[model samples]
Target: MTPPPEDLASEDAKIPAPASPDALRDAILSVAAGDADSFAGLYDATSARVHGLVLRVLRDPAQAEEVTQEVYLEVFRRAAGFDPARGSALAWILTLAHRRAVDRVRSSQSQSDRDVAYESRANTQEPDPTGEAALATLEAQRVRTALEQLSERQAEAIRLAYLDGLTQTQVADRLGIPLGTAKTRLRDGLLALRRIVSAPRQRKEE
Candidate 1:
């Protein structure tokens, strides 16, 4: 079934404001540099959605919880592997969550079944994108529209890296492109989206 308009509007509400790239960079640096509290902050910042993605794909809260830990462990273990050039730290962790969830789903069941499950649960829960400040949903829609203007490949790469939980290598593997191609697509895609998001007034003026 198609998502209800309200659901789409609510979906718009969950993406949050642009995380301070500098702050996020600092967090990743902390983790990479061995500060435990910084690592905890990173986990706390992203765990819910990661858990939600897991549960959506697996439909098991217990398994989702386990996967959540696994996702973070991987994040901590692979902190050095994170590529800030591609996107924000949050996007990196989210990509891990999505890809891990995808792996669990695909490893056990048919892709079609997993997609159906993912879609069914998606409309039921809304992601609260606002970290603290109150931003109206209408403004969120405007941002979403701006994001829609990016090249499809760029957008796809971002989704794959961030939402699908694939590494740049895995993205290249899945897309049948070279690692360099995946990296380029991921970077260009995020830059395009960032430009659209950063210049909201420009888009509005247009």
Candidate 2:
């Protein structure tokens, strides 16, 4: 992973806007043809946008910067496959950044969930089978009711991600939408479900 730059604040103001579409297309073609120097120019022209999109998705400067580097490496390796008729170079680059950032977020969430589950199991006493079954049934019903409160798209994203064990990318692919849209649905759905689940607890405490 690339380390976050020490002078990012100072450099951000100096970074110019992205190159023209024609210029970027030419640069990508040059890079595809083995011109390493063109890769530098392409990075300069689009790195800010790439990093910004990644940061927006990741909300972590260090991780965004690292993933931004990974996106560029992917771009360089796959530049030959870029078709100008399909889309502009910048769009393609940003799409790659978004996918990579989403992947990183999912990977972090999976690890965190695993750690929490492990700790929970370790601290738990021997199960009371009857009591456990009753609690589990109630919890499942509550969750199902909460899920029904979400919009169809939001609920679908949550189901694919949590129940089907699919990544955000997979959810996007399954729904025939972009990865960013899938992420938004999942995030919004989770927030809504959180509110629904906590309402009873708040009422009980009141």
Candidate 3:
């Protein structure tokens, strides 16, 4: 596996010995008190073990690296609530890493399942030409209405680029405007169109 970044690595030369449990606990306490140096030391000393556990659960180097960073961020945010009576500092940190890794795995699986289900439905559904034509007409009407909401210059830019199938450069040439101005019009027009089109759906959802 690829090693972590240099800045994240422990500065072993600075300390003659490995981090003791007492030292880790002290670091956590200091971290809770907003000591930046203590937080850095804690991360350096414990990151390897934390990352290893997360990587084992995730089984993907890139994802493990991301989750390890997230785990440390959570540790920093919630450090003030660490309870020595309930558990050791290392155990607490490890638990956070494990939980975050598992959550990532579950979230990935859920998204995959949703994609599979959508594909299955799309494949099995029968085509209805009449209904499809009606739907397409309604969609086109909606889009035209949305286009009407934009300024004439913005609307002209969108139609030239999208409906006329012109590149931004071509659109600029056709409109006799600078390429940057053409891009700005297209961007603003699309944003306004999206808001206009989605307003009805937003109201229904609410």
TM-scores for all predictions = 0.45, 0.51, 0.51
* lDDT: the better of candidates 1 and 2: 2
State the lDDT at 6 in candidate 1: 27
Per-residue CA lDDT of model 1 for 1-206, tens digit only, reads 22232233233337463345577677777776556556656665666656665676678875676567568756765676787787767667766776787667666676587578879888766546664325545645654575578787877776666555666667788889997777567545544554465465467899
lDDT score, residue 93, model 1?
Answer: 71
Q: Give me the candidate number with maximum TM-score.
A: 3
Score candidate 1 by TM-score against the native.
Answer: 0.45
Q: Tell how far residue 79 is off in model 3, in angstroms.
A: 0.3
lDDT of 3 by residue, 1-206 (tens): 32233322242223333488789889988876666667767877887787777786789986787677667656765787899887778777877887888889988998799788879788766546678579968866886777888999999987776555566677889989997788577656655665566678679999
As a TM-score, model 3 comes out at 0.51
Q: How many steric overlaps are in each model, in order?
A: 4, 0, 0
Q: How far off is residue 64 in model 1, in Å?
A: 1.0
The parts of candidate 3 lying over 4 Å away from their true place are 1-17, 123-206
Ranking by TM-score: 3, 2, 1
Kindly report which residue stretches of model 1 are placed more than 4 angstroms away from their true locations once superposed.
1-19, 110-206
Tens digits of lDDT, candidate 2, 14-85: 455557779999998987766656776787788787887788678887677667756765676578789989
